[model samples]
Target chain A: MKGFLLQGKNLSRLRGRLKSALLVRIAVYLLLVDLAFVFAYPFLYMMVTSLKSPQDVRDITVNWLPSGLHWNNYRLSFSLLGYPSALARTVLVVGGCTLGHLFSCSFVGYGFARFSFRGKSLFFLLLLLSIIVPVQTIIVPEYIFFSGAGFLGTYLPMMVPSWLGFGLSGGLFIFIFRLFYISLPRSLEEAAGIDGCGAVSTFFRIALPASRSSVMVCLVLSLVWHWNDYFEPLIYITQQKKYLLPMLLPGLYRIMGGMQDASLSGGDALGDIYTEAVAMAATFLVVLPLLIAYLFLQKKFVQGVERSGITGE
Target chain B: MKLSYSQKRRWSGYVFLLPWLVGAAFFLVYPFVFSIALSVSDLENNNFTKMFFVGLANYKKAFVTDVEFVPKFLTVVTDTLINTPMIVIFAFLTAIMVSRDIKGKGIFRALFFLPVLLGTGFVMQQLQGQSIQSGSLEVARGILLPEKLQAYLGYEITGYITAFFNRITIVMWGSGVQIVIMLAGIQSIAPALYEVARVDGATEWEMFWKITLPMSAPILLLCIVYTIAASFTGSSQVVDYIISLAFGTAVPQFAYSAAMGWIYFLFVLAVILLVFLMMRRPVNRVAQR
Candidate 1:
């Protein structure tokens, strides 16, 4: 009878433990869902609004959904954005810059990771400084230099610095590569060294091959930054004909006649024709390629960042 | 004539770094010094050849004469102060959540990181609807909460909600990279440490405070620095004003723009250095352990 009473007490304790664990799990899930909604609401709003017809957009009752699918918004924006050319140019610049970062950043990173030399600490400090200083601070002089060099209005100004590992957030890329390379075991490289493989060939053959995940992280980041950035392109490519995708956005706003206050414009016929829906559609189309690429690369991208060992030793 | 092994290694390191070194001289150092020179010299009609030394007049204008400059600069400073801590804390918390052995961890990570993909560029600005003038605060009011709810919630409560959502929007959008860095830091911590703590009769809360936080101190510092840099450099009123000064106006005030940029850069650098100095010793202590 005493043993039976002890077993009952143990069972109740276990049950109580399980109950609190369940409650904690439910609470965690609730918090996660709420945060997720906040993160995702902007995208949802954009998508829904992009599909709304003019009448539906005007209707006060319509908030989340449109009365019907409006394909015309997409159609109009697609044609008006000069989608094909702008997209091609964007791909070209982003691709070139990505390739540039992959080549130069890794090479520089490998050097820092594998070799020790004089002023190494000082160089690293400068690298940190490079990352900290805003590009705008030095852009005026760089612009003047590029203009004097006759590189303005061409893609060279954008692509050359990246190729040399000094482009947009280039120092950070090198730092990422350095951290990743430092984390890797030296046995393979040492073995290759003993085998007379030479440093360059060893890097090309073994080190670079093993650092694929770091490469992936850099590639995604570089591509997205270059794709989204309008500032440098705006400064360098002054000609309207050579405008990159992001540069075209502001111009699109101007053409939509939507830059002025809508109420003051009094909802003119052109404003109605080009409406907020069309603008959202253009924005959607602009981001569609990156979004699709991200969806496919999501798993690898997250894993790659985790494996990059960005938290230094 | 043969070189020592250490000498060869040093030479090769320089060889690999040659491109970057040259690039830095031109891209970083020259531009850095040249901008300093430009700040003190007035240029007319984009003609550097016709430039004249203005003797600190541009800096004086920014500080003393230009009414728009000081107020806008202060706004940016205050905004950075408010936003940086929020981004860092929110990111660390979210990183902890997603790093847990939860189901759909990948999806949660992706959603959390969506801002890194879409937040910076034209799409976000366009979506925020006033395009040029609308800040994140305007964005929250315009879209996040419905018009009816704002009316129902009344002016004061709605103002509070709008402000809350404004901060949330900014923090969530900016914290993506920080979250990734923090996650990496947490995951890199040894499981053995946690096991030992548990064996010592420590609770989950204790383990987090004693093990997770201290071990990730270096990364926490990094995330703080990165978020601070992003806040300063990424789209802000000061940056926009500088851009307009240099390019947007009919007669571009290149020297004035350079002066203003330098002021902003110095302020940002000062803040970062102060933070680094404050955090350095603690981070090193944890690292030594």
Candidate 2:
């Protein structure tokens, strides 16, 4: 009878522990879902709205689900955006800038990381200033300089600065690379030096390859930034044929005309409702490449963020 | 004839820094000085050829004469002040959530980081336009707050709550990078530390407050600075206003725009400096601890 009582108490205690554990798990999952929804809501909304027909969008009862799939909207948006050419140009600009950043930033970062130089701290301060100062502050002079150099219609204004390690958030990349390199063990570089490898050679052959995570971080980030950069491209690329992907957005409405008429006519207009679907479709197309790339590369990206020593030791 | 080791190192360092040195001299230093010159000069027909010295007239106009600049600038300032904390806190929480040992952790991280890819520039602008331009506010409020709760909270309270919800939508979207950084910071806290805390009878909450929060203070400051920079530079009312003043006006007020830009830049610098100053003691304490 004593043994039975003891077993009963043990079982009850076990059940109590399990119950709380279950509650905690439930709570954690709830919080996760709650936060995730906030980030996911707009994308999901865009996706669903993109798939909705004009009539379905305006129907009072229709909320989440559409009556039928509207592939035509995607078709319309694709043609309107001239997806192929825009994608090609975006790839060119984003690719060049990313490459420029990868090489130039890592090089400069290596300098700051591995060696002490005169004015090093002062230079670092300037790097921080570059990160903080709005490009708008200096864009006027930059515009004048570029226009005078007859480089306004070209990608040089964007790509050249990036190549020299002062492009969009280039300082941050340099900072990241510097941190990662600082944390690296010195014995390898020392051994390489002992074997008569020059500093530049050692950096190129050993240090650069070793900091793969930082490179990945720089690559992914620079790509995203350059891809999403609208203002710079807008200011420089005046030729319609030269417009990048983001530049396509502001003009999407006018290019895909007939929708504005319904928008102008107050409410309950078919054109008004369908325009959203098409616009959502266009937006989705614009982000589609990066979104897919992220889905595949997210693990690497997250790992890159962690291992890049961005949260510095 | 061989160079000393330190001398060799310095020479190599200069070589590596060559790109930045060249780039900065042309792109950074020149533009900086030129912008200052532009801001202080009066230009005819917005051309440099017709420019002359104007001293602080443009700055004076921005402060004392321009009606639209101050209010818009103030709005940007207040928005940043309110938005930055909420973003940082939300990101911290989301980072904690993502850092947990859970199933499909990759999916959660990807979902959370989606905004970093899409939140800025054109995609965000388009989505925001669609929602605001359409009747989505009504739908959003309807979904966010039920009728019973709205009635219970009263009209004014509900209005405030809905407004908060709207703000939170933007906040959540802006937190992608912060979440990633915080996750990294939290992950860097050694598991051994947590184990030790657990052995010492610390609950999760206690462990977080006593250990994680204190340790991650530096990273948190970095996030705050980053958030401020991102908020100011990202597409916003102030940026739009500044750009319009520069280019959108019939006679591009070149000097006036540069002055306003300088004014805005100073405000941003001040805020960033303020953040650093405010967080210094706590961060130093963390370092000491």
Candidate 3:
């Protein structure tokens, strides 16, 4: 009878501990969910608010949920925000930047990794300096230089420097690639060379293939940067038609300001308010490509982070 | 050692390096010199030719004349001092937890790392938008309990608390990169060392302090440098403020903005050099270890 009672006590104690552990886990899960919601809520709010009618949005008691769905807000945002033209401009600029980084940075990084030459140390040091030096300080001089060369207001200023393996900071990728290349066995490159491959051919055939992970990392990073970059696009691309997505979204604020004077005379602030909502919607549209890319390639994205040695640092 | 014809491939190496050398000299060096010169020269006339050297004047103006410079610099410094430690702690803790034999470890790792993919600029813009929206919401909701508690601690203390919150918000959004870096560092550490420590009956706390911290010092240094650089470069608030101050309200003329940027650049350079020197000893020690 005593043994039975002790067994019962032990079972209950075990059950209680298990129950508390389960409770703690659930609490943790809930907390994580709450964090995700907090981080994501503002974006959700922006999207839903963008889809609402002007009246619904401006109602005295704001709707946490949209009263009705409106895809027209997207269409309106496109036209009002000059989405098509700006997106094209953005694609061209970002695409150019990515290609430039891919080809030039790889070639330069390979050189730094494999070569022995006079001024090798000095040149590598120069690359490090380029990474550290703030580009803003040189923006004016570069503007003047490019303008003198009749390259200002063209994609040339944004594109050409990158082609020369310049302007990209966080030399971490290039440095990592160099390290990776150095660590790679030289036997394969020698084998390729013996098969009548030159240095360039060996690079293309052997070195490049081996460094795909690092290259992917550089590509994704460069693309994301160019897509979100506001300052350069704002400075270099003056024409409204030439504006990138980031430049265009902010330009909406300027457009709203311009409309302010005209709207006051019309005695209708509704149009202005609606336009502001549309502008916010346009910002959402600009962000969508990146968001989609992130969703799909998140695994590679994390792998890239790890490979870039950012995690260890 | 006797070098065969294939073994002696010196010329080819240089041939491969030619493009980089040319690019650096033309694109990097020339512009760097020109920029330094531009910072010093007085631009009375429109042409680059019509420039006279005015040593220390721009730096002087940045210090004495510019009201925004001091406050902005202080803001950045305060931000760095606060955010750097929090990020380091958060990243280290997260790495340690994820390294443990926990359920759903991969998922937690992935969730913590998602923000790195959403680049700094996008995150900052999102944060700006959110802050503006939430600021209004807090006012309207009269959610002053947290604020009142903060105030009861006294104004300076409350100010720091608020600043700390703001810095953490920034760091949390920005930490995906740092966390991944720290995770990689933690992962690279040999399991045998931990096993040995466990066999020796070392507590988890002792193992972390004795093994994990020292082994990960190199990466920690790298993170510190990267974080500092990112904070300085990626902050739009600072950039916008600098641009506005330099260009006035109407339009950003190229020359004046350039000059103002040089001032900011010099300040940043000094800070970086100081930090680098301070970090050098730990890095050397790590390398030796």
**CA error at residue A127 for candidate 1, angstroms:** 1.2
What are the iRMS values of all candidates? Answer: 1.4, 1.3, 3.5
Q: Which portions of model 3 show Cα errors greater than 4 Å?
A: A1-34, A59-63, A194-196, A254-266, A269-275, A307-313, B1-10, B95-123, B129-163, B236-238, B241-259
TM-score of each: 0.94, 0.93, 0.84
Could you give candidate 2's per-residue lDDT for residues A84-168 as a string of tens digits?
A: 9889988888889999999999999999998988988888888888889898888888898899999989999999999999889
Error of 3 at A9 (Å): 18
lDDT of 3 by residue, B188-259 (tens): 777899999999979667998989988887778767767766767765455666666443465544344556
Query: Could you give candidate 3's per-residue lDDT for residues A48-87 as a string of tens digits?
Result: 7678766565564765666787666788778876777767
Give per-residue CA lDDT, model 1, range A43-140, as digits (tens).
88778988988777777689887999998989999988789998998888889988998999999999999999997888788788888889889888
- The CAPRI quality class of candidate 2 comes to medium
Between candidates 2 and 3, name the one with more favorable DockQ.
2
Q: What is the lDDT of candidate 1?
A: 0.84
In the order shown, the candidates' DockQ scores are 0.69, 0.74, 0.39
Location of the lowest summed lDDT over 10 successive residues in candidate 1 chain B: B128-137
DockQ leaderboard ranking: 2, 1, 3
Model 1 CA RMSD to the hidden true structure, in angstroms: 2.8
Q: Distance from true position, residue A292, model 1, in Å?
A: 1.5
